[model samples]
Target: MTDSGLEFDLTRRIGGFILRGRASLPACGIVSVSGSSGAGKTSLLRAIAGLDSGLSGQVRFAGETWHDGTCRMPVHRRRIGIAFQDTRLFPHQSVAGNLAYGAARAPAGTPGPDRAEIIALLDLHPLLKRAVAGLSGGERQRVSLGRALLSRPRLLLLDEPLSAVDTARRNRLLPDLRQLLLDHGIPALHVSHSRAEIAQLADHVLPVRDGQCGACHPLNDWLAAQDASHPFSLLEGHLAGHDTENGLSTVRLGEASLVLPGLGEVPAGASLRLIVRARDVALALDPVPGLSIRNQIPVRIKGIRPQPGTAYCDLDLALDGQVLTARITRAAADSLSLETGQSVIALIKSATLDPAQE
Candidate 1:
């Protein structure tokens, strides 16, 4: 996950709403653009693709300038491919036909996309002969991705690609999407409001807020900072192991074993970050016996801090070198005799950890 080999600084004012942001994307893997609704996420993507005209600023790719405040490049001239939430594949075409459309439209002298490679990369061989209208939501998305790949664009933009699918459908298609971006070495700009989508797929996080581009960090750090409005903490670890049949994984955090929902094909030792909401964790003075809950990490209370208007107090736990924040009612803290330096066990469930927190 490196930069997109491009630099962008653009500003477009549409009436009272204005979108002003800048980013330096690496040449490899995926970069995510995230923010609350109406925060210019979509407009930014459109501007880069040349779909939104009148955008002023610089859009530089490689060493060539694409968009300067004074000059605008037409959409067809830019070597960028985009896949929107609708995935508008031609209704009369088959899966293969749709992909071929992209190949046919590719610029002359450009290295045409290998049909076999596109088919295999997206696992679309099974549906090649199927009618486009008959495809499932996940299947449609895969075909859409294949079509985009066949276009041989220098940069790919995905706008909330998974928002239309149900959870089961998303899970079914995620592995293919991951391989498409990683195995194929495709540089992409992905836009989404869903934290989980950004967490699992993006390495570089670009947070857009109030029509401005803020600091960029690894996906995990960005998510942790989001839940500060409530009592929650962020933790990052390696994907130690997974039980596909059960859809769970044993996550390694320092010396502790934290099992959570399995992220498909997350290679062993792959870094995984989780958001542990304050309400999901329980504190115990001593280890309880015969518990089905999986996470029971030894914690030493650091201190308690008060949040305005809330009856609960934020408890800081020293788990290895990382601090875990927990929100508990002040009454519960006093009843359990919890205080600074008190030895305790933090109880958590594998189901409670949100993958998007990463």
Candidate 2:
């Protein structure tokens, strides 16, 4: 896994914009490239896949050399499969025909991917005979993925695969993509601007900024560092049990139970990533009984940092030693007489945590 997944050192100048970035992607799973608009994410993908001829850099995947300036490979010769946000399927072709387009591209003598495998991976079985133009947005995107996988690519490059669909459809298709990466062990370079997409799909994250590739970091930790105004904390735990009567899922953070509501149909023993916002956490002196908050973990106040008009308190929950931050007004802090070395309960609602399948 430490082997460099993808590398680029070329530069391209487009009018007033200079697109240049160097990064090393992991050798397995999804290595996500993220940035603001106009940060050259798509251009970078094209450069890596040999689709952009205007760039100058050595692009290498595994031990194979792709571009070395003098000898430039054509797109068709790259053996790389690319799937964009748009399905770009042939309007006149049937779904099977569209998929066969990629299937036909496999190298001579190599067995192509099975139709059922592609269909099951992307849930495209029902629409196998449907016309490309008749499929819905999500279905078309799934078919596009199937076509790309059937191409038998050495590397798969996806540029905002879910961006073209509506939010609801995007949510529906993400899990399928996740299963593809995990179950099939296909390595991918997934480009996106959405944090949630990266959280759900990426096992390794490469954050691109200012036309330069930065160091790799874990997806959750990198997301927490994005904003200083409202820093976030991450808790990684397994779904220990379910409380169906309360509509809450119990996450086992060491020995404590974190009850969050609206956890829709997650299987037991699945890893859960919980996001506890600083503003949503509250501190208490003793275990109160009359409050609506269900969590009352015994924690020690670690440190209290004060701002101009408010104060930020950091607490270390005993369970897994997870950190919980509470932003309170200066007056509120004074009223509670909060201080370091004090004991409190970290109040949290189940709705605040994102119940995603890891």
Candidate 3:
């Protein structure tokens, strides 16, 4: 019997740089490969995709071996869809032609969106007849992504797939892309440098550092382990109601509620994932009347850690079993006499709350 999911232990040497990666990932959901530049992030993906002949090690997916000591499966035989940052579309092909090429290569009876659905999802209708040479950077990336999805591969590998798209558009597409991957039951290894992208779409994080890829961690666990400088929290809740006059939406998080703006149009009861930066949160001993902050939640101080070099400190606040991180000056924390298990209010500006695609 073979094991399910993806298991890999790959190593490669490029000139003086050596890359080592090992991980056992779930067979579903988006797994993000995150790191800074030249961290061997892409090299790891290439080794798994069978694009690196110099790589040595094993790559097993869903119990099938793609790479091992002597035998090596060809890249095409691996049945994986890949989209790179450079948007490598065929120069001679039109947008439709490029899409058709990917569609033609899809395995028979593969599970995924059909050609028409892909076109619609990427909004490629108008650009279908356009030449690839004329497409903008963002448009090319979209087309490349659409083509990858059209192939209906069992596994997807994306290397900074939306780096060329504007932030607003990328944010809008992330939710739909995440849903699509789920709907099709395609497990993806997504590589990105953006924390926002990983926070919004990744179910798990695979950290690449110093030319090595570490074991996977759940998104929240990974976020909590980071330093206080870029601390953040990911919250999940259902849209409780919308106040049209106030142009705000209330999200129910167990017994607590968070009010946010620009969510009035989101249908009631829709699930939402919110990203709250630690810097954006403030703590108060008592609720202040007529404050500009729209969200004030009752929370308990779970833990506090001081930043060694800075005068600031990090606080772990708990609300109805959910954890929120906050960074405040040591003076303020001392002035209020903050301590573990102490109840306080977490004040968040409505505008500062960024709701990710549900």
Candidate 4:
């Protein structure tokens, strides 16, 4: 089969740090680049975009050789749309002017959203005529994103795109950003430090550690490898129905079902992704009655991992072939004598379930 994704084995040296980035990322969907400060995350991105002249080794995208032992492609020739943390908008131009410039430079027959669609999607209609110098940090980032989208490049690279936006605004924009990528079939490499962003936006995770970028992993596997403090699992389902009276929504996942906070605005039968935190799940030996918790799923114990020197243990559960995690005190595990293959009830409070656009 022909390889249809990004493949790179790059090396660069910045000051005293030697950076190595190596990965084979999918051709579609969002891939999050995660790492700490000074870990070469930005450097890796610059190298891929052909901005790092000192970069050495191979870089290929969808069978196209961007960089090789002796040949190198120019940045513009690579046809990538990039939004940096600095929000590199043209200072002298109005918001609309910057957006128009991007549109004008788009290569003929490039496939993506049109100018009107992008302006509405990013809520840029109101700020179209405003000068770039007068915009707020969040507004600047939004404009930067709008410009990039208008270009309709084959690949998108975002470096902390939403960092300047407030939590509430960021939460609302994330879904729209994800939908845009999916709708246009634009593959992206998103660099973010926010766990919520990763959970909501990432289809695959590329970890940068100790100045090296690692191979991409599925979202579930990446979450499993995280520490207890970041224990989260993703569940995919379709919205089955909604109860307007009680303000709740029902989602169908295979043979299993879940009750979540009212998502009435979302049409019935729409696909949804649910984020469940391990700490919010309670385990019980038997089904309890008359509880406020809305979801009581019958799951079989798959495995147990005890956190050393900590009071808690993470239980891997199987519910109709889907995996759910529960974190409870070690004492509770001993008292219940939980064992592999034992069937138990997993209690989840409906309010704690966060639904994301899929």
Candidate 5:
């Protein structure tokens, strides 16, 4: 295995089912796994974590092999942080005690967050004194998340840690989870079935099908192939400035600048990744102003995919270097005479951003 990031090429059998997968996780940021139930998602994570001995082949990360036919690293020595759907907290431990248990496992001399930072990032201050047994599902997951981070693991394996939390708390905590991963800068493999979750969090996505790992795609391309409701694209940019009076902020998308509807208090010059839904993007042959859409960038059509069972097509547009998608009716496409290699303007309303996805 090349020693750049996390690599796995393995074969295993469980209950008469054969699983063969090969992938190299990105050196940084979240690389999420999506698959159906009983499709070997958890088994893959378990193999990487050294929790499943039945898996054969190899697992390597950060220039070291954790497993092979002749050599294996103990789970304790792998330096991985794992948070499953199950909280897995100590039955008798207080919230603080459980977190301490994780911090206690930190590898000597490796740099990571101290107790205070973990507590604040996951908003665990209120539950520090509470027993793990008494906390609500969301609260317990927070503790689990904190515990995982405190361990100072070089790799993180997350198995739908948000599945148990209520919808209200899930929405509120999504941003926190994004920030925590972004702040840590370690490579994390998140197992999830929700396309929204994958789009909201993952930089690179790997699709697992019938026990095999498939090619990885950027979030934008993955979502375009999804159903009509999931037409979205993520573009990386930087904050240009803010308009406090009008509640607007300017973001530079490649070569152009967009004045978005209020991104409260975001400082200028900070790198930002913005999410835009394809349905919200309207295409035009020429730049027109004065209506209401705040963003209109010149984009070249790179590719097109007709959305099955619908009258629309998804246009893969390249704006300078970044890519975005536009979902418009086929009739609209025919009327405008759109095709690959054609240049046009992509119009977007700034209000479509849900800050949580940023």
Candidate 6:
């Protein structure tokens, strides 16, 4: 099968609220649907997968017509894989058995991924023969992912897989899941209410507003919308090396290096994206050493955004081509004589996180 994009112009009414939106997913990247609870994220995903027949509109994927005014493809025939908050694995079955059940559904003689590749991608080798009853929340999610992949689906659907776990566990699991989606190269639509999950995983974002889905936007815009008071920024970097004595991971963003807490044993050259909040960053006109902070990156001011009811404004700073934001008082801005294209150093709190949140 081709690496096909999915598009839909759908409208569905459940109770008094109506869900209406039109959007498209790229041929080979994860698109995240984001909104508050009961805002139609799951409904939209369900409708796209042919599980909700109440929808009326066109559902097209790649070059094939899955649904329209005159035709509706059978849900089973649509070739989609799904993982939800409730993983619903068979308690009586081993993890391998549950995964194999998906493999068994593949049409004979159709060339697709084998179980071994899927197992490796999800890092399920250890849990292969374990009973599903003993799996943790994160482990269950992994099995669910494996089960979905083993089916050799054309498109994968994830509905709040991380939402089921507690904050701490969710933080650890996000990297693993992001790596899996990237490694498999499967086009997926991930549905979640957590901005952190979307920030960590999505290649593009579709924000759900008032039950209506908005057009997709680049990752930067979605991330920058976190909050006016606590503006968010996205940084791309690679693992420089681990400082075992300090128990930190050095992330190199261009020539700048940040010593982030919690040393993950990632490979030296693995690419990593960090979500930095304005509140986590401090500013200075010159470099100061031997402080509590572990990061002191020299950045040039790109622009400023003012927030209502506060003297603090968000500063958009640049390091090489990467962008970051700092929240500081307007008084500080004047005292430091900060301006667009002005050079400054940003002091990032070492504990800043992608759990971003705990």
Identify the leading candidate in terms of TM-score: 6
Model 4 clashing residue pairs (backbone): none
RMSD of each: 5.2, 4.7, 4.4, 4.4, 4.8, 3.6
Residue 17 shift from truth in candidate 6, angstroms: 5.2
Regions of candidate 6 where Cα sits further than 4 Å from its true position: 1-4, 15-17, 90-92, 104-117, 133-137, 165-169, 262-271, 304-314, 329-331, 355-358
Off by over 4 Å in 4: 228-231, 237-273, 283-287, 297-321, 327-345, 350-358
Order of candidates by TM-score, top first? 6, 4, 3, 5, 2, 1
lDDT of each structure? 0.76, 0.72, 0.85, 0.84, 0.80, 0.79
Kindly list the per-residue Cα lDDT of model 6 for residues 1-358, writing each as its tens digit. Answer: 3426787898888889898979877888788988888888888888889897678888899878988999999988888889888898989999989998888877787555678867765668999889999998878987887788788777889998766566665555556566656666768899887776777678899988778998798777776665544566778777888878877788888888888776465555566677777788999888887888768888889998777788888898988697788899898898888888898889998434453464
Pairs clashing within candidate 1: 2-26, 3-25, 3-26, 3-27, 4-25, 4-26, 4-27, 5-26, 5-27
lDDT of 5 by residue, 225-297 (tens): 6554666777777778888888888888777887887455445665556778777799999999677776778
User: Which regions in candidate 3 have their CA more than 4 angstroms from the true location?
Assistant: 229-231, 237-257, 261-272, 278-288, 298-321, 325-346, 350-358
| Best-first order by lDDT | 3, 4, 5, 6, 1, 2
Candidate 5 vs candidate 6, lDDT winner: 5
Clashes of each: 9, 3, 0, 0, 0, 0
Which stretches in model 5 have alpha-carbon errors above 4 Å? Answer: 167-172, 227-232, 237-275, 284-321, 327-345, 349-358
What tens digits encode model 3's per-residue C-alpha lDDT throughout 145-233?
98888889989999999999887667556666777788889999999988768877889999999898887999888866764357777
TM-score quality measure for candidate 2? 0.77
Count of backbone collisions within predicted model 6? 0
Task: Using lDDT, give the best candidate's number.
Answer: 3
TM-score of 6: 0.83
Candidate 1, superposed: residue stretches over 4 Å from native: 1-5, 13-18, 25-29, 35-39, 69-78, 101-123, 136-138, 150-153, 175-185, 204-218, 234-255, 259-273, 283-286, 298-324, 328-344, 353-358
Give a tens-digit lDDT track for model 2, residues 1-358: 3444666677887778778777767777788888888888887888888776678878877766788867787778878888887878899999999999989988877554566777875667788889988888777877888888888777888988767566554544565566655665668888887777776677777777767777778776677677666755667666777788777777778877787765545556655556676677776778889898888777777777776543544444444576666666666777888777787777764333331322
Query: Lowest-lDDT window of 10 residues in candidate 4?
Result: 349-358
